[model samples]
Target: MTLPDPADQADNPVGGVRTTSTVSAPTARAAWSITFLVMILQTVNFADKAVLGIVARPLSEDLGLSNADIGLLGSVFYVLFVITGLAGGFIADRVRIVWVLLGMALLWSLVQIPVLLVGTFTALIISRVLLGAAEGPAGALNNVAVFGWFPKSKRGLPSAVVTSGTSLSKILVAPALTVIVAAYGWKAAFWTLMIVGLVWAAVWLVVGKDGPYSVNSARERAKAGSAGKVERVGFLRIAALPTFWGGVLGMFALYGMVAVILTWLPSYFEQGLGLSRVNSGLLFALPSVTGMASMLLVSFLTDRLVGRGMTVRISRGMVSVVALFVCGGMLAALPLVDSAWLAVFLVVAGYGVGVASYPLMNVTVAHVSPERQVASTLGVFTALFSTSGILAPWLTGRLVDAATTPAEGYTTAFQIFGVVAIIGAVVMALTVNPERDRARIAAIDPLACADSSADDKY
Candidate 1:
């Protein structure tokens, strides 16, 4: 079947429903219910994939593997994640959000069954690849589905909430896995995911839809908004955007580090730091806790500061600089610590600060792209971010394999990675020539006129 024109960014979703604009209180409430349901699917996407890494502690011991081998397993996921993510944005441009998300959710989660039989490295590698492939679409497609509901002005918190699901998963997964792995063994964890997956599939069926309320719902609202809203943003144009590139590089640096930790850190704590499984998880989960805090606070701070007349660049920079500095200091200090616990503390602290940028594009896409194209714009953002995932884990693996000790591996690797984060910090700190892009965007506004289906309420 022919797909929707990839360049079309009308407010109408793949299902032909216009999913933007105000609606009746009851309908609006219904819309929120759907949006939050999507959040649950996304939470599963994060929690399932992340919880795997925590289980690596037990899984490795069961299989008698080294940190480097486990790192390879993580690398497999990134590789497949890149493959799926590479085209997820374009697919979002053409496909219905619900169908794509549902199919992918079921497809990826089914792969977890193989982990129960993971006695060999090759078998585990295949499972990770399947997991990555599943994850790729969920992150990118969920963004498209989400941005369709909220207006540009209100996107900050909602976007953060969706993105924060990953953190929420991290907080819950660490300790939970510690217990599950101890009692039922690694096999039990995958079985738990299997059950959750089926339940989530049911939730998506009931609550998932085009959006909170659509253009039709708008005229039904207490506050009737404007009329005749439309949008059209395409890959060709998004590729030329300077801010898009900035987000690409910035998101890459941030996620590459995260992929590194998710795959390698558990092994690092066990071998390099000499901690028990529970203590090691608690120590490792520190960054996620900090990340959760930043996810909420930074959005409010960015939106508030920018509203008070700060340039977009300056507003974004405020969080980036301080966060990166904290990240850098912690990373640099981690290897120097004599105590393993001290090292764990420093690493998590630095990582927490660095990762505040994880949700940066959620806001940037809302502002820089056409309202209707929020999902497609975010798809590219996630695509680029996943590309970084492809490389960072492998590179971390190579580094760990090369080093005699986990401390040396992380130290040298993070030193280089910290420099990369600093470069992003400098870029965010500098003011973008908004005038340059403003004119470029203005020149394209005429073409945007052709997108008569655009919904301006978003």
Candidate 2:
């Protein structure tokens, strides 16, 4: 099939240039199809991350591992995460993103092979490290790819949809994996994920193609003189913005909390709350149900607000600030609650409310960044915050090991993260001003800002 020249199509307008009269129905369908496919990729990506947590009890028992050892296993997966995330972001900016995604998915499948073959702790660490490296860039790359399919005004919902893959993993993939662990064992779950990754890669290889608003398409438009002059900016200059740092700090807290949830939540429910494994899995899935709904609602509303000419400060920044605060409050109160069900409610509500920040912060950062530098900027943003992944799991393990009781340790950990989330809210409230940041960026690179505003218009 011949690819449609972005120069000939007006549907995927960029930089305020309209090459055609109206967007075609086919183009819209293709955009959503690709968006959903990327969403599925995210589902698979997060499933890989959640598998260890789901099987934590069984894996720890079979291997005769302690809580600290399990935490270390969780921590090890992030050893190369930040570095690879940065490198992958840069790579995605220069290369075709479809190829980058395909490669990562294939590597994800291959990394599981070692663990499947060798069930030792050392082998597991090796697998985790490799998997971390492969998956580190997945989030940023996926968002950048999805952003290429939709205009600036319409990006929020799509971004939410893409990131919601994490919630989907918890809600859908986690329970299924838990069942597999219960019936067939932890190793069987790894085998299942490996096969799933390979299957996704095969399908992606055949169907994946860069979208009309992609970097390649931008270059093509430039060449055709349809898109105005495309100018690039230094990554450092972009990173120096207050908006960038604030979004990073807020996202850092959220990711740390997410790491704790992904690495230890199931264990927490089973050990700390005295729930059976099956019940714990079901409880674990509960938060994502709310999280998914909140995420979609927030994103959809943000897009609508932006369409109505609302400032991103209100549309994106304030929303994130509020979410962080709500999340922090609920998490902090988790330990104070007497009932196990109440504690569960805190986890579910806090996580559900706070997760709305992910897409908002992402889109906010993207708004301030030069279009060409978005992937790299997002990479740095993700890399810095994702370091929390390394620290959170390890520290929680240490906390649990040091506490007199597992329940006390778990409560303490949740309280600390809750405080972190509140602090994130304050930071976001002070620093996130996308309108101001966009103007600042415009002053540094006028053409970049022009392109950005033009893209936002449609």
TM-score of each: 0.83, 0.94
Q: Candidate 2 — which residues are off by over 4 angstroms?
A: 1-26, 223-230, 453-458
Taken over the whole model, the C-alpha lDDT of each candidate is: 0.63, 0.85
lDDT of 2 by residue, 165-217 (tens): 98999999999999888999999989999999999999989999887667666
Score candidate 2 by lDDT: 0.85
Stretch of 10 with least lDDT, candidate 2 = 1-10
lDDT by residue (89-134, candidate 1, tens digit) is 5665556677777777787778887776754677777887888887
Q: List the residue pairs that clash in candidate 2.
A: none
Which candidate gets the maximum lDDT versus the true structure?
A: 2
lDDT measured at residue 68 in model 2 versus the true structure, 0 to 100? 90
What lDDT score is found at residue 58 in candidate 2? Answer: 91
